[model samples]
Target: MKKTYKIKVDCAACANKMEEACKKTEGVKDCNINFMMLKMKIEFEDGVDKDEVMKEVLKNCKKVENDCEIYI
Candidate 1:
C-alpha cells in the first residue's frame, strides 16, 4: 500500500537522506521525500503493518537527520 505523510526536514539534501533511509527500512518498498512540500510518499511492502513500519521509518530517518520529524 501507499501512504503520504507530513514531514519536517531542514533541506533538500536531508530530505534525500530521509528518502534513502526510509527505502532501506525493512517494510518499505520505496519512498520519496519532497523538501519543498515537506511531505513524504511511502510504498509499503506487502502485508506490512503500517504503524510499525512508519515508526521504524521515523527512527531510521532520525539517524541521518536528527531533527527530522515524520508525523504518523
Candidate 2:
C-alpha cells in the first residue's frame, strides 16, 4: 500500500536523508520526500501494519535528521 503524510524538514538534503532512512526501515518498500511540498510518500510491503511501519520510519528518519518530522 501507499500513503502520503505531512512532513517538516529544514532542507532538501535533510529531506533526502529522511527518504533514505525511511526506505531502509523494515516494512517499507520505498519512500520519497518532497521538500518543497513538505510531504512524504511511502510504499509499504504487503500485509504490513502501516501505523507500526510509519512509527519505525519516523524513528529512522530522526536518526539521520534529528529535527525532521513526519506526521503519520
Candidate 3:
C-alpha cells in the first residue's frame, strides 16, 4: 500500500537525507519526499506493521532533520 503524510523538511538537502533514511528503513518499498509540497510518500512492503514501521521511519527522519513531521 501507499501513504502520504505532511512533512516539515527544512531544505532540499534535508529532503535528500530524508529520502535516503526512508529507503533504508525496513517495511518501506519506496519513498519520495516533496519539499515543495511538504509531504512524504511511502510505499509499504507487504506484511509490514504500519504503525510500528512508521514510528521507526519517523524516528529515522528526526535523526536527519529534527523538525520534519510525519502525520501518523
Tens-digit per-residue lDDT, 1-72, candidate 1? 999999999999989988999999999999988899999999999999999999999999999989988888
Instruction: Note the Cα lDDT for every prediction shown.
Output: 0.93, 0.90, 0.91
Lowest-lDDT window of 10 residues in candidate 2? 63-72
What value does the lDDT take at residue 60 in candidate 3? Answer: 96
For 1-72, candidate 3 gives per-residue lDDT tens digits of 999998877899999999999999999999998889988999999999989999999999999989888887
TM-scores of all predicted structures: 0.97, 0.95, 0.94
In candidate 1 the C-alpha lDDT for residue 65 amounts to: 89
Best by TM-score: 1
Cα miss at 60, model 1 (Å)? Answer: 0.4
Expressed as tens digits, the lDDT of each residue in 1-72 for candidate 2 is: 999999999999888888888999999999988899999999999999999998899888888888888876
Off by over 4 Å in 3: none
What's the ranking of the predictions by TM-score, best on top?
1, 2, 3
Residue pairs of candidate 1 with colliding backbone atoms: none
